[model samples]
Target: MEVTIIEDQFILKTKVFFNNQSLQYLKKITGSRALIVSDSIMETLGYLQEVIDYLQESGITSTVFTGVRPDPDVSIIADGLKLYRESGADVLVAIGGGSAIDTAKGILYFERKFESTEGKEMPKPLFIAIPSTSGTGSEVTDFSVITSEGEKVVIIDEFIAPDIAILDSTCIQHVPQRVVADTGIDVLVHAIEAYVSTKATDFTDALCEKSIKLIFENLETFFKDSKNTQARDRVLNASCIAGMAFTNTGLGINHSLAHAFGGTFHISHGRSNALLLDAVIEFNANLGGSADGYAADRYAKLAEVLKLPARTRREGTVNFMLALKRLKKSLKVEDNIRSLGINQSEFEDALEQLAETALLDRCTPTNPRQPSKQDLIRIYQKCY
Candidate 1:
């Protein structure tokens, strides 16, 4: 049992906050010239005022950029970059879910480039990502997903990773039930995928396993009663842990397939993850080779976490699919990619293009079981 796992190295520079009050300290530490990048939904949730008041209390100067949209596009990043330039922001504070954080990271990346070009060589803009929803782990990872011409492109660089991650349960208190459900699916996928990732190391594997257990135990509670503080805390922490895990261990078919679906159909990332997760798990289980046994064993562990029987490989495979079915039903999630408003004609129209784009996605090669072009198309068909 003392197997030495490979060490995956990444800069975990982000500090964390438990309660919302830590915003004051953040502003004080950063000397108050912060630009807040948030989405319309968060602005409506009164987080905007809460953040502003905290900043004002600390005598911090802040500007707001509320233009981020769901599944942020590259154009949004450009907009944020413009704001970052014009405002001369010293810190980039992100106060929402993955979308806001991803958008902010992209903006910060470009902001540094612009700043460096002007000979004003400032340190990379510091970012604090406060996740209002418990998914995507964008708060901690150096990875940012941006859409470009209907393709999900992942930007990875240490400079783009957030400097701090603030997890406040109160921020998630008013989130809709559907968001919690959908995002929980992403959390689960992150942990499972990281567990079996080809890049998995001891540090990431530990985080992934812990994340899987926490998500498995508390997701239902958080969904059933959104106000359950303990459940919400567990869920949010699990999401962050999974984020750190996958950032180093990386993701596999689940994310590649999700990115493909997200880019083509404009479905939310979590929903995309949910739709393709089981299918990819099944596909991977049947894949046999040098690493196949190790992969299958990890999948079996995942099955056990889901309370599915894992007595044998065959049983574990069956349980994985059945568990996904039960999970979708429990979460009131729909099957059929068509439900995402993607017509059959549209999918048929984009099959070849989707296959090509998915092959190019950053998350593809790190898959525990690599899929061929035909396999990718088949997976798409299965999800479809």
Candidate 2:
């Protein structure tokens, strides 16, 4: 006899605080000692001191580790873990962009893994994440993209998700407009990819739909006027909503190729995702001819939801890509990788290796379209 088991679950364990309530929440957080993880950027912006001051207000003694960098790797995580042990803090706080949050998660993830492997038991510290950027959604997602050697390794585990996510849009008000454009595009990619992901359930679809709509409504406004509180709040909320969707549904090859492209070229993660979004969507939709597949249908649904002209699935998909391109232009992003000023020869030289690395990326398995290495290379070529 043959037996089959079916399973489905939606998890939202992280408590989220919106508006400017993050500082208020900090005052009430339980813990006598805290370890704050951030980066030099946050420090220079005076945000690091702000967090320390709030923690002090709550009578929580703390230690700071401001060594996190963009695209944190194993060595960086190792250094953070060493600090975490030395500091002996009962609470762990990550108060910067995705890099700081990912670094914090990486530190905790390795510690937890080692404990399980070595047959040791230890109580997990209270983990809190305050995102300075609306991108990555690392605060609520269990996925961590860490660069190891030369490849970006995505570590996904239930244990890595943060216990609390504080969304204070004011944190991003001082950020550069270019960063606003990059992170906002990343949000769109997250929602679109999640909506079309093979693992997407009804719950995830609802979140993605809301997120995509909000992004359309608010991203450009926020990018143009960083001080628009209304736009900032909406876009920041949209980013978290998209994160929730993709965290459940998982993303597609857009993220995989972006991981490879960013790791190889030392490009920003959000920009890498932005450059690959159009090509990946086209590849998955199988644009011109066949629009009968799940991917095309979902893409069409997105276009319809966004109120783009869509008489058919193929039309809807194309229209959707066009809308994304329009958005990119408005945000002052380049049309392709070539326009981003990467040398053609250098990009060409890395295509094969990029394709190979992308093929093995953790995000690839759930991609609606299973791509060959050549298929991936073709995507890179298209983006170029």
Candidate 3:
């Protein structure tokens, strides 16, 4: 194994300590005032009070910004940026899943460098992302995705990476099963895509492999029994690991399709990823030859890690489909895009736009196969 392959920098620098006790460490280093960005659901879940108490006990005041929504948009992030600037918060603490964390990232980014988006440097604020769910490892990565006019926009920079990530296992206790399923599948997609990505390196490959094994072994347990702390912890750790891997390696066609469709239709990102992942994987597999065979080998490795029956390329493809099928059934997730309330005409009309948007997405460049507009359309059609 080559320890030095290329000049690659994996800048997932967030210092994380799991379990509920990590809050004490967080309380110790936090400043006088921190902005806690979360959503209404999380606030109602009483996490806000718990965090506020922790802050107050440590003599650190906090300003709460609880307006974040699921699959957060640019407008929501802009609002968060305003709140962060007005509140004079020196530190930003995100206390939910991806939405809250993405919002916090955007807010902190805006505050540190560009007040008006006119003239600014490349860096931003020191952020702390504490995930309350077991997926969408926004806690660890410097990538933030926000929507604008039904298009997914991403901001990726090392400066946007959080200064700290506190993964309290207790946070995963009350997450709904649907969320677990959708985000868990997203985790799986991240791991698989990272392992096979053109940008994959030794560092990211290791993280991706470990994350795949963890998700394979524990995600079902989490879905079966939501209170299984050990399983939840494994899944949560895997989520962060996958995030680290994909942040460096980027994603593949699964993400490209998901971003395009979800952004256009207002569907959940994780669910969109889940629906398209298997289809994209199959499509990538059939393109044939050395590079394509390498992609198949990666999926075969993932299948073996998951203990699926994958000896040949065909078996590997079967394993991928079966595993995804089991996941969909276990989670009671629908298979088609139409089930998400997107009519046939809407999908057909948006097909060209989706193809264009996906082709232009940042993740598309890293895909093993650089698919064309026709390829994207065919992939989407297969998914439907």
Candidate 4:
């Protein structure tokens, strides 16, 4: 039988909406038991209780696992999974940033692994993700980044994609300006990498184009004024739109290198991506200071979309990189990892392993330029 390629995600399966407390869908949940995965910040912010109260009102008993940390490792997943298996829950709710959502996903992932290992298939729980931060876009994406032995592992699995995504502006209201900067820049990297990915298609490009425009228009205002509700909504939309794009088209080396670098140096994922953005862009587009291939043209197209200077491929690419640098400066995020207090000797010592791990990251193969281990080392060295 002749068959066509079936893209893992053609239409987003997750039901998405915006609200004040992310409580609009609580009444619609069909399950009686829920495993709520979250973190201390959500507990401190009272968002955790809000979700719990909502679930209680829906007549759903819940198991709360609030031990999720930034860049969740295997141990968190194992612990959460143990709770999940023991709770006998039919619903999984992740109510925090990417870390918390990923913890829930990781639990589900290993749950599936357990089924496979034991030659049994358990009915998957209904998964819902409510992102407190406008970065990672973990609410809608079918990918999860987990830290294992000081290296970030990107787990790509369609089964773990949330059944629903809730964007609650209230949760983001008190986000630190520095976090806003980092998260907002992460949205840009997602859009850019998806746009230039070798696997990109017209459908993905359209989402990426809109996402990029939204970030350029609204991110600065959102960062500067947390009270700007309009900007907040737009940034949130941009994040989800970019997620839709990259989850379909996959991402590139910016993510790959960021994953490795962030894990090793204990940098925030978004900040790591921001530090690597400029060099990754230039590397993908050029070799020896001249624009190289289709990736350069793709970048030039993005420049055109942003209405930057795109008269020629090189000019457009340079202007685009310059624009990103300007945005980073405005946000006070410098491009140097060392300035983040990573020891020079430790960094130099880690370069080889970083490059090796980054080369194996799921995002690397989609990079417009196929990087060698030496190439990654050079990129790391240049950024340092």
* Per-candidate clash tally: 0, 0, 0, 0
Error of 3 at 302 (Å): 1.6
Q: What is the lDDT of residue 159 in candidate 2?
A: 84
Q: Could you give candidate 1's per-residue lDDT for residues 323-373 as a string of tens digits?
A: 667767788887878777778988987877777777777888888778887
Taken over the whole model, the C-alpha lDDT of each candidate is 0.81, 0.89, 0.81, 0.89
List ranges where model 2 is wrong by over 4 Å: 1-4
Prediction 3 TM-score vs. true: 0.92
Residue pairs in clash, model 3: none
Candidate 3 lDDT over 88-184, as tens digits, reads 7767789998888988887766665574466655334447788887778888887888877767887787777888888887777788888898889
Report per-prediction Cα RMSD to one decimal: 3.7, 1.4, 3.2, 1.6
Q: Give one digit per residue, the lDDT tens place, for model 4 in 275-319.
A: 998888878988456695888999899899989989989888988
TM accuracy, model 2: 0.97
For TM-score, the strongest prediction is 2
Candidate 4 local distance difference test against the native: 0.89
- Model 3 regions lying over 4 Å from their true place: 1-6, 113-125, 287-292
Output the lDDT of residue 234, model 2.
87
Between candidates 1 and 2, name the one with more favorable lDDT. 2
